[model samples]
Target: MNPRRTTRSSSTAKAPHRHPRHPHNPAGRGTGRLLAAVVAATACLGVYAVPAHAAPAATGTEPVVSRGVTIPAFYNPPARLPAADGALVRTEPLTLGLRLPGLDGRPIPGTATRLMYKSTDAGGLPVAVTGAYVEPSAAWKGGGPRPLVALASGTMGQGDQCAPSLALEHPLTIGNKTLSVGYDNLAVYRFLAAGAAVVVTDYAGLGSTDRLHTYVNRVDEGHALLDAARAAHRVAGASITEGSRVGLYGYSQGGGASAAAAELQPSYAPDVNLAGTYAGAPPADLTEVMKGIDGSALAGALGWSINGFAQTDPSLRAVVDAHINATGKAALADTSTMCVGDAILGYGFTNSKKWTADGKPIADIIAAEPKLQAVLAAQRIGRLKPAAPVRLATGIQDDIVGHKQARQLAVDWCRKGADVTYKAVILPNLGDKLLTNHLAPLLTDQGSAVSWLTDRLSGKPVTSNCWTMPVQP
Candidate 1:
């Protein structure tokens, strides 16, 4: 008999959701005055309270910083995008009154610009990607020219509405719905607070009118991220120079992008002066990660990869269409329009075996096909050498992306002569395991990652631990 494959599910498991980081804001004299006014008004009419500070709308044809344009196609390049990579195709000012997630009502103080820049896809074809360039309120008083960080956000679903640029304006926006919380915004705000200029890529095709996001496609993500850094310098009023020390920060999907950028920077974007990178819980090995998450709480991620591969790779698309059953096709179609929460809720604990015509799971089917295997292999990270020092953090007991694969990335990168610091957060308690697995590390490990990037930006030397460690077995 064939060896039985094991799978886990969170369908019946009950636990408090892992809470993301929230910005710290104090309610002072202004809040007190508002409360006093509300109390005074309770005597007659019970209707009134002061509204939170709202960000004003942008005046330009292409909005600088409103949620997003009504007709996004208007922003699209009329003709073919220029052949040059990292060229700034278009830019609009993002005003200072926008709100950061977790700190709603309080406007973010910074100069933010929405960018449309040229980048390459998996096919190496020129494409336009959307991004945001932000210069913090506090000037860069650091020793050298102002440091710039190319920040990539974690998975926010594959919809155009899930774009980080739109989320920056109204923190809770996802198309027409208002979820009121965005986990990645917290990290972006943290970078800005450190007085570093930030360039955040929505990644290729994510917020664009035509292309569907090639989620986790290494070349596409890396190209979009590096180009975001290059385009940041061209944004009007953005003082980032070519000489600025650049760093990379990302977790989950973003983590993969940052890691890819680090590897591809030498040849793809040699102009970027990379100092260091911090990648937290990157799904470095998609094959392993897919198998691990098949029946887990984050099973929905598998659907995302399927949808993405189908969109980007025609050979894989043919395989998927031929193999997927009616249920699977419907499931995949439904998820195309979903945001992160909907994805998790809609597909959590669902097994792929139910979606296939044959009894085998999707992974098994993919493994049996050479074309599918090759596509996945091509998307793998750790094969290429990153130009800068990289710090990778992961919870040892992670259930979603799997700790073994994440650890393997550190080992692989080290073998490739990368200056690697692999930090594993160890917590053995059952409650801790429940809370800290997978996504929780995104929030918990971010501070250390940020600090690591900070030291690099501050011109501190990075010492490699790869030589000291024993070889991976």
Candidate 2:
């Protein structure tokens, strides 16, 4: 069921079509002269010239913008959720623009297209969560319901700017950096080709005006997934029939998000028809993840845990604000906009020099902070069985989140009588190669995971091997 290798297809779908001339470009004297000449030439050929200011007719090429305005920072939530029950809602049209605010409360100046989805908050008010969908291409297919693949992005040491949207839209395509892979739109492209709709949540706060991303917050992650699906279906005029299947895929930070989504869907979004989820190398036990990656190559992950917990629980931040030195405070701020590489390069090799005084390890500093300890303890994911079918994969040599923890999660779920399809691969020669070791199982085992989803969409009965477990380590 696993894909033998990962490769890009040549005939993949392109972005929607657009006019040749730039719409925002100014018409100056020289430009006017050239336009006159072209007009004369057109007249000679018996063709009528259109006015420069004439509005171009709609071509279905434009992206759909959300109906809601950007959530202002000072805005407070109403006592009830907005009423969002309608046949399908379409938002205004918007050309790609830059400097837009993302869910993280930071200004991300890149090509963006917004869409509105349908949902109802706890109070039964019709609710619509705005989506700032961004991709590199402008020639993507504009019609039909594409496969919806909700990405659970990994933890970026900093805040929301570290979101995958940055790379997906404005990739580093020049020089040595060019050799480096930018954003991974492969998942989106793959599902799109399969005629599936894809929606990548900015999580609750990463791309919105919210102050924090809520990191491993189960409720927040669940809300993003459920609401995003509703939004995509509404904006795209796509239908999520009773048999419509949904799949969740993520790694590390995203893995945690996917796992939480799977666990919370039954109660949180009982209506969401989640067929199956693919959780790769999730940190089921946050405590172990914190302890294991404290000062190793993956140590940069600690920064995300710090920022996420600080943003979710006020008590956690008070502890951090008190224990961290001035340098640590500065580092935390800078981490917000930094990418994974920047984070690892800056603080990976070095210990929490900025956060601690007297040369103490960063973990020790956190351990001494009682409030932070409670915050870290709150992020754990266990004692809950995921309602949807799940396909969990992990590499035996994984060093970031550790394979043992992933295995333990599967065991816990199995014990709870939940349907689980767990796969553990022997990637010994891989060492601590995080990406490959973690993702290979998911990508390679496409037959089981993705095919299973296809079946769910078709309303086929689901079968699993949850009763069986691999021999103990």
Candidate 3:
């Protein structure tokens, strides 16, 4: 789970489906340029880290607006939730921080509505999740009713302000309020430009103030995504309908979310007309994934996982809390309030060994503690067969998120008779530990992934490559 950053000033960058609810690539030398740009830009990030303006939500329904960023007040759930999951909570006009106006004065990409909808968490409790629904002004040339895409974001961070809905409004934000790079805006607009409706979930507890963002919790993520689709149909002006062919798109953390949703759709959200799914570098096995990024550029994300795991499972929390040292506690506290960019610049290449009371890395601790291992095992995504056709891809040289485990997900699905298309992306090691191998493929393979999903949305069927996929690497 991670982020591929983009910026405006220079810097960068949600749900559960308990009840029936809604809801790529590698390449190129440009990867070298991108890696260099990131390195160059990071050295100066400290100067920009100022304190943000604050607006507390103690009494009224008011957003926390700081700099240009906003965490909408609508995120607050009512004390009473509707009987059905995916029930609409509220909606507001969401203005895009970056938008192109056509000659006629209409946003060329689309008009967006801020959404708060009900979704069941992994614990089967009702939660209010926030997101954005975009109705494209562009015409659909590829198909039937305009296809609806539920776009799941990769690892943003653990902060409430890091929500993708807010990012759509403020593409670049920094300082105490948040440190973000909204690279996903390009992906959002791409689908809009293709004449598709898009709904983006903020996930349970992410934008909502009820709890901590449960990062990489598969059931929670799957339910949130599926519920977003269910709620999309309720948006008053949205072009999305129950009949619209639904496509899932995600990479990194989002990859796992989309993959989970793909499997859960048939049972948890029978109403969602799922057509195809693209899961790029999915961390299907969290045990392996947790070890993969431990000392990489975005090592702070490990704290996010711990913070999330602790929030949902008291057993996991007990284990983590007992073994964690003061350094670990401080790191978790710091990362819980940061975005991916903040994590990268601050905790890059730091070892997890520094966090443990016994000076052992978390993976080793889990190896010694079976209770923690069970938590990770429960989070695994490959056990169930994914619905519809799925395109799973991974970078061969990825040091973060683990390429082998991602490919294994495709193999697992293939064995269970799911239609699968697997791609092994070959990329030069642009950075030894700077995340180039993992992040590069996201940018390079995006076009091919989008085309693949669009083809399925357009009713074009693809043949499965399962027969040729051998276990050997």
* Global lDDT of each candidate: 0.70, 0.51, 0.79
lDDT of 1 by residue, 302-417 (tens): 76688777767665666787888877777665555445644544565567897898968989998899988888898888999988999988777776677888888888999988
Candidates 2 and 3 compared: the better one by TM-score is: 3
> Best by TM-score, which number?
3
Put down candidate 2 lDDT per residue, 1-473, tens digits, no spaces: 00111111222201111112212212233333432432343232122121222232233322111111112221112234445532223343323212345565534322334544444432243443344343222122322223355666665433333334433433331121111122334454454445555666656545332233455665566566666765555553343334456777776677787887888788766766677787777888876676667554445556555665665554566666666776666555544433454444444534565466556776676577676666556566656888877878776777667788888888988889888878776655443422335445545554555555555544456666766676634
| Best-performing candidate as measured by lDDT | 3
Mark the 10 consecutive residues where model 1 has the least summed lDDT: 1-10
Error of 2 at 464 (Å): 2.8
TM value for model 1: 0.81
Q: TM-scores of the models, in the given order?
A: 0.81, 0.67, 0.88
Shift in Å, residue 195, candidate 1? 0.8
In candidate 2, what residue range of length 10 has the lowest lDDT sum?
1-10
Per-residue CA lDDT of model 3 for 164-237, tens digit only, reads: 88778766666643467666777888889899899998888777756778899999999999999899999998
CA displacement after TM-score superposition, residue 127 of candidate 1 (Å): 0.8
Best to worst by TM-score, what's the order?
A: 3, 1, 2
Displacement of the residue 65 alpha carbon in candidate 3, Å? 8.6
Alpha carbon lDDT at 47, candidate 1: 20
